[model samples]
Target: MFDKILIANRGEIACRVIRTCRRLGIRTVAVYSEADADAQHVRQADEAYCIGGPRPQESYLRGEAIIEVARQTGARAIHPGYGFLSENADFADAVEAAGLVFIGPKAASMRKMGSKAGAKELMQAAGVPVVPGYNGTDQSPETLAREAARIGFPLMIKAAHGGGGKGMRVVRVLDEFMASLESCQREAAGAFGRDRVLLERYIGQPRHIEFQVFGDVHGNVIHLNERECSAQRRYQKVIEESPSPFLTPELRAAMGEAAVKAAQAIGYVNAGTVEFIVAPDGAFYFMEINTRLQVEHPVTELVSGLDLVEWQLRVAAGEPLPLRQEQVRQQGHAIEVRVYAEDPDAGFLPGSGRLERLRLPAPSAHVRVDSGVVEGDTVTIFYDPMIAKLIVHDADRPRALARLREALAECEIGGPKSNVEFLERLVRHPAVVGASIDTGYLDRHLDEFMPAAEVDPDLLLAAAVAQLLAQERAARERAAGSGDPHSPWALADGWRLGHAGKRELAFVHRGAPLALVAHGSGGDYRIEHAGHDVVVNGARIEGDALSLRLDGRGRRFRVDSDPHRVMIHDGERRLRLEPVEVYRRQSGGSAGGEDRIRAPMPGRVVLVRARPGDPVRAGDEVLVIEAMKMELSLKAPRDGSIAEVRAAPGDFVEADAVLVTLEA
Candidate 1:
């Protein structure tokens, strides 16, 4: 084994690789960008170095700079952890040229599997089942259009050189083919530096399954079962599990053999995943093979009782296969959910901010958390917004799902919005519980998981009680150092000469102003809001938990608060209450108006399709901004003529920056 290795990626995957390296007595080196100077991975590694600017183009994708870091740190091997440079064949070849071992498949094999078009051709010839599509090398726009017509509507246009759900689109009709093709090509070129695409016949309601395949220097290859990755949103997997509930033993064996064959066809070495799209009839078609470790590899680890990173290290060191295919076992079921710093209600818009309060479940034998951040760390805009990966394991899928729900309840993230509540609902949905969800099910029925915009009367009272108790505690703490600490003046209970006065507070709930009136304090109160009055007693906040009574019923809720908003959680339901000054006036403008288009996150403007005086209809894509490796289309909010275009191609803009405005 190599004495020291350099991790050429950041975030959870980089930190995860370090853990296995530490276990095997290998020193780990971490490389970071300016944004990740004080990142958790940097603190955890034995040594760290700053490569370049925060953007991926300036840092992570600079293969030469990464190679130089490996040389300076005296790292004998470099592990490209899942993203950034992980699947870059040229980078792997360069690392080999520098006399450093690349801890993944050989460059020659990566070359064979780099292009989705080429990989499909290779797989068909190797006797593995591949989807019928256009894999030819004609690069003309006319040729692509002609091929789309022949392939028929409801086809998939995927970036031939891209993976990870970027640069891919599904066209439902021929009328939308050209536009989808252009958008897909642009995303592909931005993400992978390649604009070539391949068309595949769109499989309806297919389950996305993939088998883990490993090969060694001795030309030995083996399979590590499969993972069910059907629960996806926009081609990005949200939930993944091992021992797919939809697969029978016979189908598993057949897919496993096909996966191994696909790997051997390319002389694949080290770790890789052969992805497949499976129909309801047990028939499966080959999806592109991922040439590096998958983001959801923890599910495989939990079921198989093996460290895949450790296997990659040993394989890269020229060791033989750890175990033959028949020796591999799938003991139990495991489920994993990716918790992201995104707002599900806002089209799952990813955000970057400080994690004012991040509380995740503690790791146990049954639970695992792989994250690179802690409570005080900031999730920068320079990379993926994955907060954590929550993995649960048990004797069966039902038991594992129960653990997953319980573990999700233990999570409380404060600063930026998260999908914790959404995930909780997802795990309980009938489609997921019954293991009947397809790849497009989440997107098709998203409203079923999203809570109604209307707030409940009980929730308002709970928020009022929780907020009042929290304020009372702060007041008591302030009075501790005063001369007359016990004086009633320190209290904020609206004390009057003969009767207790109502303490009025202002809050914004569901975008509407809410008036709250509190009648008492000292763990007892009456809350009146929206013509409803309720008596509350025993209201107190301890740390992040709130216990109180509303009307005659006892209530308890989890409280996560920052200066901006207070989030109250009761089971899987959550209500975000923003406290405002009682006398503060409201600010309004067209920045968030129907005639204006604003950037949802901090990103670089990649393309602007609208100019001054251009007529556009509602929902027309007027601008595209690339943020954190995803292209966001800023659409026209209403049918109008474009009055102004402030952002241009290649311009970097902040969150909520006005990109375009239409005539009122």
Candidate 2:
């Protein structure tokens, strides 16, 4: 093994690589951008260096700067952990040219598999089943349209060089073909620097199955079973699991053989993944090959009882295959869910801010958490907003799914809205629990997860009580610090001896103003709101949990709250409430009005569709804002003339910032 290796990426993957290198007695060096100066990965590594600014292009993507850091730290190899330059053939060649091991596949192998079109062609030559699609190099729009007509409707337009759900679109109608093609090409060129695309038949109710493939310099390649990544939203995998419920022993073996074939055909080295789309009839076709370690590798590791990173290092160090195909075994079932800083109800827009209070379920024999952030760390718009990967393993699929739901329920992430609650609901869904899922399941059944707009009285009471109790504690603490601990005014909350009838508290729950009246003091109080009186016998908050009693009924809820907002998680439902004053100031009455269009999240305006005095109708696309690498389009609220365009393309605006004002 090498003495030292540099991690050419940041975040959880970088930290994950460091742990394995330390185990193998290989010193690890970490490179960071300005935004990640105090990142967890940097603190975990033996040596660290700052390459450049916060943006990826300014730092993490700069291959030469990373190579220089590797040289300076005396690292003999560099691990490109799954993003940025991981699949870049030129960067892989540069690492080798600089006399440092790339710690992954060679440049030739990456080039052959980097382009989806090229990879499919190569797979076909190797006698591997491939999806029927147009992979030719024809750049003419007419040719692509003709190919789409030939392939039939409801086909997919995918960027030839794109991954991570970027630069992809589904054309369900003939008229949408041209528009979808343009959008896909634009996104493809912007994300991957390659505008070429391919057309494929869109498989309805197809399952996403990918096999973990490993290869050594000795020409030995083996498969590590498969992962079911069919549970997805917006073309991205939300949950991944090994030992797919849909796969039988015979089908598993066939897919495994095909995966190994694709890897060997490309002369792939180190760790890679061969993805396939499985039909309902157990027929499978090659999707594409991920040329580096995947985000969901932990599920594979847990089931296979092997450390893929260790294998990567061994293979890079010129070691032979660790185990043959027959020796490799999968012991149990493992499932992983990616918890991202995003709002599922609001089109799953990415959220960015300081994590004022972050708490994760403690890792145990059956549960593991891979995170790159801690409390107080800012989740900026500079990179992916994935907070952590929560993985759970058990003896069977049912137990693993149960454990995953429980783990997500115990997770507490404050300040930025997260999909933890959404994940929990998904796991508990009947279809999901029964293993009846597909790539479009989440999108198709999103409404089932999102509850009705009706408010729950218990949740509202809990939020009000918790906030009141917290405020009372703060008041007493401040009075004690002022040397007035004996004062009765400071000692009593909602019981000031003289003026004590009903103390009203105002809050906003899901945009509706709420008035809560508290009648009593100490731990006992009667909360009345909207003509509903809820007798609170007792209420107290311990960490992220809140124990409360309403009219002789006891309830315990997971509460993640700050001064401004409080999120109450009750089983599969999560309710977020904010202080009325804070909400008013943030929304400013014009948020839902027809007079102005405001940004839903903080992001840079990438496309401006309306100019001053331009007329637009309801649902007309007005602007497109990019945040955390995801684009959201703002639309006109109603038919009106654009009085003013407050933001232009390339301008960074905060959440609720007025982008365009309509004439009143």
Candidate 3:
């Protein structure tokens, strides 16, 4: 193995690679952008260097600068961890040209597999079953439209150079084809620097399953079973697991052989994934090849009992294959769920802020956490907002799914809004637990998961107790430093000298105002809110954990707080409660108007389709905004004329900033 290796990436994957390098006595060098100067990956590396600015264009994608860093640090090999430069054939070739080993596949293989169109052609040439679609090289708009017509309606327009669901669109009708193609092409060019696209027949009940394949310099290649990535949102995989519940032994064997064949055809080296789309009828079609260690590689590692990173290192160092095809085993089932710093209620828009308190579940023999951020770290807007990947391994899918829920409950992330609660609901969803889901499962049943935000009684109770506890603690700390510990001014709750009848406290949950009234004193209280009453026998707070007895039932809740906001974490749900200030005057002529269209989140306006006075109907795309590399479209709320366009293309606006105004 090489003495030192440089990781040409950031975030959890970088940290993940560093761990294996350390295990094998290989020193690791980490490259970071300005935004990631104090990032977890940088702190974990033996040596670190700043490549460029926060934006990927100015930083991680700079292959020449990264090569210079590798040279300066005397790194014998460079591991391009999944994202940024991982699949860039040019970058791999450049690294090798700089006399540093690229710890992945050969550049020639990457070039062949990098382009979706090229890969489909290669797969077909190699007799690998490919999806029936237009993989031709005709770039004319007329030709693409003709091909779309030939493929029929309800087809998919995918970027020839896309992965991770970027630059992909599903058109349900012929009328929407041209517009969808334009949108898809724009996204593809912006994301991959390639405007070319391919059309494929859309699978009605598709299931995403990919096999983990590895190859050594000795031309030995083997498969590590498969991972079911059917649980997706916005076409991106959210939950991935090995030993797919949808596949039988015969099907698994066939897919495994096909995956190996696909890898061998490309002369693949190190770690790569052969993705296939399985239809409802059990027929499978090749999707494309992921030419590097996938983001969801941990699930494969858990089931196969192999350190893929370590294997990659050994293979890159001119070693033979670690194990033959027959020796590899898929022991236990493993499930991996990505925890992102995105708000599920807000259309899952990516969130960026300081993580005040990030407490992941303690890793054990069954649970593993791969994260790139920690407490006090800031999840900036420069990159993916993934908080961590929670992986759980068990003997079967049912047990693994159960442990996934438990693992998510043990996680506590405070500051930016997260999708942990959503994930918890997902794992427990009937279809997921029963293993009867397709790629469109989440999209079809999104409403079942994202229930209307209402005042949860348990959450309210926990919040009230947390607030009371926090006040008492503050009072005690103040009294300790004062001259008299018994001073009435130091007491927190206003319950002295029988002066209590009905005390009211106001709060805001999920942006809706709440009025809570408590009757009685002396440690006993009857709380009323939203036509519901709860008898709180008593409550106690020890640190950030609150113990409360509501209606004679005791429960413990973990709480985190700031001055005005209190976050109550009960089981898998996290609720944020904001205390309403009594002294503040309520002056509003309606905070939001139906005619105004606001940018749901902070992002740069990428395109504006509606001009001033333009007529539009509800759900019409008025503008598009890009944030954290994902594009979101703002639509017209009702049938109206665009009264004004407040934002122009390339303008960066803050969250909730009005971007357009419509008039009836």
Candidate 2 deviant stretches above 4 angstroms: 137-159, 162-197, 471-486, 496-501, 538-545, 560-562, 582-599, 607-624, 634-651, 659-664
Extract clashing residue pairs from model 1. none
RMSD of each: 3.4, 3.2, 3.9
Worst 10 residues of 2 by lDDT: 492-501
Predict model 1's lDDT versus the native. Answer: 0.89
Query: Which regions of candidate 3 are displaced past 4 Å?
Result: 138-155, 164-197, 496-498, 520-523, 541-547, 554-564, 569-574, 581-625, 632-664
Model 2 earns a TM-score of: 0.90
Best by lDDT: 1
- How do the candidates rank by lDDT, highest first? 1, 2, 3
lDDT of 1 at 193: 94
lDDT by residue for model 2 over 238-309, one digit each (tens)? 889998999999999999999999999999889999999998888899998888999999999999899999
Full-model lDDT, candidate 2: 0.89
When summed lDDT is taken over every stretch of 10 residues in candidate 3, the lowest stretch is 582-591
Clashes of each: 0, 0, 0
lDDT by residue for model 1 over 1-664, one digit each (tens)?
A: 8999999999899999999999999999999999999999999999999999989999989999999999988999999998888988999999999999999999999889877888899999999999878978896889998998998878999998887778889999988988998999899998889899999988888999999999999999999999999999888898999999999999999999999999999999999999999988989999878899999999999999999999999999999988998899999999999899988888988887899789899999999999999998998777899999999999999999999997998888877778988998999999999999999998899999886778877777778777777777788988998999999899877788887667887788646788888998887998777787888888878887888878779988888765556778787677877777521332244248887789888888989998899999988999999886678988998899999999999898987788888898
lDDT of each: 0.89, 0.89, 0.87
